[model samples]
Target: MPNSLNPLLQTHFDTALEHPNGIKKLRELILTLAMQGKLVSQDPNDQLASELLKEIQVEKARLLAEGKIKKSEALPAVKEEEKPFVIPKGWEWVRLGEVGEMQTGTTPETKDQSNYGKFIPFIGPGDIKNYKIEYNENGLSEKGLEKARLIKANSIMIVCIGGSIGKVALNDRDVSCNQQINTVTPYNSIFYHYIFYSVDSPYFQKTILQNAGGSATPIINKLKLSKIPIPLPPPAEQKRIVEKIDELMALCDELERLKKSKETKRKDLHQSIITQMLEADSQESFQKYFQFLTTHFHELYSVKENVKELRKAILQLAVMGKLVEQDPSDQPASELLKEIQAEKARLVEEGKVKKSEALQPIKEEEKPFVIPKGWEWVRLGEVLQKFGAGSTPLGGKSVYTTDGIMFLRSQNVWNDGLYLDDVARISKSIHEKMKGTKVIGNDILLNITGASIGRSTIFPLNFEEANVSQHVAILRTFTPSIVTYLHKLIISDFFQNLVFKEQVGVSREGLSMTKLSKFPLPLPPLAEQKRIVEKVDEFLALCDELEERIGKAEEKRGEILKGMVNDTYSRNCI
Candidate 1:
């Protein structure tokens, strides 16, 4: 290894591994640099690669004379454009065929009983993992070996076909393998690791991809594999490069192990802290836990998963009436319910809306949790003027238009807010046809079906008019202020758990409007509802900021790793 390059390689290897994928990319960078001859310095005293090439040719000629291996057709000379990079002084470029003998394997007939049981190791792509040849789960008999190619130990094995393409491994034992693999036996012993590293390099893999041809499945045949060019260092330098790669790779493995260990520790600490907070018995203990959380928030919520947990906890606290203090001066929720009942009755009496069917009373056992003094439980149907699912347009996607009334699908509804970018639109005539499902402002939209069940948002005032599909329900309340509170309830884990229970045994069928109407809601006083919404909004906004920061930090790490790899490649190889 070059003395000047030593510190550079160490610096890259020692860089903090904030992301697992980043460390993987760094490993590739190390292999790439090694293959390009930029990983180690050249020594004038070492034998030139031109001399090494001559030795390889002599070995191949001698092997051919001995009739040990079949002579293949001469490969075309390497074109200038085919060379991915220039080598250091004394290094040379050579086709892989000149320094290796290629052999492809085949699978024995499985139906033949005589070939079933054997002691011979029969390797396949699946048996090769982490660049090591593990013991084959299936072995071939002597008769099976006759039907397959037997590759000797120390040979380089590469997957030439199928989804496992470009995976290379070095065998520690003589093995017979199936036809998907191509073994490259180096002409000289010195070229084994060098060839292995070359085939594993990103440059060589790109070449394989460019040459792979087939309509159904891309593949590289032995002939095409033989012609792939490789940058050759002197035999001594090859040894040095392989040794350096081994050292750096070992370092990378250690780094990855350490990262996983650290993450496990952080996750344990994070879970313990959250458990203490959620399981706190009284207001005093809860406040103490909250104080600890605020002081050590960054340590606990540095990861996206931890931040997501924080969001869920906030919502849980909000719905349980534990988020804000209840004021004695505020009106109780039972009184608020009476007023809503009166308004509902007045509308029914005036013939403005039909009287809703009486729902079964909430059983004491059905109540999921206890509520504060000012809160009361009520059915979802009791407080609404409008409640039901929408209808899909007659033509589905065919009837969608670029401009018209907004058509809200389940995808458009999110926990945070409605996403209108991918929301469809229908012609004005179609919107008129679907007048019953038309949504005006201040309406709460809930996804009542499929994967997004329970996700909801309040239809914005900016959206003058819109329609919903059958999967979403348009909910209008007696008061606009309560819609925000209801939206929060629908998104909270408390409601989601109950919603999931309602959907059980009804797989393709969605949540029934009847069942949704019967959903018991823990209603807080009108004044406290506003406070809960405000506090939830405040904490959720913080979670949003934390999530965004985590995302940016991860992205920044990726960019820095990419820049380091690209900058190194350009400075040394370009």
Candidate 2:
């Protein structure tokens, strides 16, 4: 390898350690440099590639006379414009067919039982992975070999059809493959792996794909494949290039393995601490675990999966009344429930909202977990003034307008907030027709059906007027302050698990509002609910910030790897 690249290769880990796909890209860079004759220095004493070409031609002529391969039409001479870059003094640019005997494979008929299994390896595009051939158990019988093209050992195989067009591998065993693959057995046996690495280089892979035709499925026929340009170096330099590629690739593999190991260790550490924090019986133990995480969080939460776990832990603690301390001066949740019920009754009596049917009492066994002293268990429906789902307008999608009242669907509702970028709209007249489902400010919109069943968001307190589809429910509370806490509860894992159990989707049915009305809720004191929401908002914001910073850090790391690639291209190759 070039002496100058040694230092750059040494720093590969430092540049790529933080990048998710850094090592994989580094492997590609190594091969690209090798293809451009920048990987290893040239030796004047070695035989010229011009001499090697003459020897290859003589071997092809002898093989043609032996009838081992069919004679193909002469490929056009390489144009000076075809070479991507200038090569070293001992190197030459040649068409790939000039280096060896090339042939496209064919598959035997599957309907013929006589062509069943035997010892001839039946290779296909699926058998090649990561530049190596992984042998399959299925083999073709001797009769099958007669009907298919036979490739000898030490051949370079490449997929020339479909999405796998550029995939290449080296096979060390005699094989018969399907029509999707093409094989090249080099004239000189020493160039077997050298040829394999050459086809895998970025230059050749790009050429293969660009030449592929067919609008429906990409395909490069044997004639097109044979005409692809490739650089040929002296035999001695070829050996050196192959060795350098192997060494660098092994280093990349080690870096990837180390990164995965570090991430796995970090995942286990963060998951273990989160488990402890959630299961802590007393506040003191919980604080101890939380404190450890607070101090060592940077180390444990570097991976995004750990950040996800932290978010979940925050929601669980908030609902269980352990996120913030309660105050003695505040009204307990049971009294709060009574006041909410009185307000609900007043609304029903005034004919503002339909009188809700009596909900079944919460069973002791139905309670998922225990709450703090000031908290009370009640049905989710008990505190709401409006507890009904919306309905679609007269004409479903045909009545949509470019500008009118916002028509919300389940897709518009998300845990973060409503998304109106592609929201459907209806005329003002149609809005009046669907006034029964009219949406107002301070109302919580819940997705009662479809894939986003458990997601919800509170409408802006003072925003544009809108209407909702049948999939969304209006969950307006007697008190505005409780809506935020209720949103947190709906998104939590505890509530999500129970919500999924109520799905009736095989019949195109939604989760029944009756079942939702009976769903139990863990209600904390009014004062504590506010504090929990604040704390959760604070922590979740930190998570969002951390996630953003991680994404930016990864982007910077990617740029570092990209810098290496651009540098090699500019400095090493013309």
TM-score of each: 0.87, 0.91
Which regions in candidate 2 have their CA more than 4 angstroms from the true location?
1-5, 107-121, 133-144, 214-217, 505-509
lDDT of predicted model 1? 0.84
Name the lDDT value of residue 515 in candidate 2. 81
lDDT of model 2 at position 290: 90
CA lDDT, every model vs. true structure: 0.84, 0.85
Can you write out model 1's per-residue Cα lDDT over 351-425, one digit (the tens) per residue? 978987888888998787788898998999988999999999898899999898889899999977788789799
Clashes of 2: 0
TM-score of 1: 0.87
| Best by the lDDT measure | 2
